[model samples]
Target: MQKLPLTLLLATVATTSAQAEGWYGSAKLNSARQNLSSALLTSPRVNERVDAPDNTKTFTPAFAVGYAFMEGWRLEGEYTMPSSSTFKSYWAPFNANVNSLDTHSQRLMLNGYKDIPLNDWLSFYGMAGVGLARIDSDGYQTNETRRFAGNRRHNFAYSVGLGLDAKVSEKVTLGVGYRYVSMGDVETGYNTFANRITARDEQLKGKLKEQNLFLEARVAF
Candidate 1:
């Protein structure tokens, strides 16, 4: 009788372990918005500070792959590609000109998640991750007709988010989440003083903060 009970316990443990470990893939649609710091552009000729456009909103796409190592813990890798944003600035000097900037961004992140089960069909999760962002910018000054491109910048990035997941089937889940990302300063395309008679090393740069509202579809293998 004792041997039979021990064998049944082992079987139960094995079954639970098998159910907890698997590979998964996910895709998310993101509505992204940015908050930029002041002093985006500068020139020796004009002492006035130029600020980046505020509350820029864009739609972006995201993807991820992960493995569940335990019942409530997982590790994932994610990527986001955002569309170009247009921003304008002005200098109040005599030869006043409207300057335009086009910016694009992409990020790669590795994250860890802790899942809390609320019921048989519902769960909540929290995740935190670190990433690297690649930012590219190009700009032109209308007055001088001078167009310039900045060197692409690779900056450190990080995000934190909370989400709710609804199990649609044995292998499918749907999720909704909110995420906040911190992106460090990046050099803008106007860094060069090509139109000026004197060359200076000062570069134009700005800090970026982003918020994302994302809807996700995930499948377990």
Candidate 2:
């Protein structure tokens, strides 16, 4: 009778371990650099599309929970925290120079990952995700005389990444990765004052893209 109880206990432990191996939660910190495509400024008085200035960089965080449904394959839902960057650019003819324009973004994604075991303690992974991004910007002065308004929009976003993972322990893994993200387009609101005075109610539109380097940690539960 005692042996039977011991056998049941062993079976329960094995089952629990097996179940825990498939579920994991992770957190990551990313150093992301923003790349903006050419921006178009449209208004009744001026309609011009010109190249944007330079890249902006920020630090962001992400979190995910996943289940390994099959060997070497996993699916996860992740949330990227909001981050912001600022840019300054000059527009010719209109003499509209942006003193400071700030942009912000946040995203929610569903990702699938394929892992290949390189050794007993090392693995390589590639991942792709699709999601929605919320993009917004803050109003700023142009040429210290005219001020532009800000707007918010939601757009479809996607990302792809590849990385190497190190198994630190039975339940923990650490990784470093690079990802490319496309966040669709962002737009700014028209300045009402400009509209009334110079009939220059203009809005700026630009595509937002990013390259990110990240460090991540995952724990299996």
Best by TM-score: 2
Model 2: lDDT to the true structure:
0.78
lDDT of each: 0.75, 0.78
lDDT of predicted model 1: 0.75
RMSD in order of candidates: 5.6, 7.1
Highest-scoring model, lDDT: 2
For 127-213, candidate 1 gives per-residue lDDT tens digits of 999989888866666743566556587889999999998878878989999999977776655444465565543344567678989
TM-score of 1: 0.80
- Tens-place lDDT per residue, model 2, 40-99, is 666555444343657998999999999876457879999999988776665655555553
Give residue 3's error in model 1 in angstroms. Answer: 31
lDDT of 1 at 56: 80
Q: After superposition, how far is residue 214 of candidate 2 from its true place, in Å?
A: 0.2
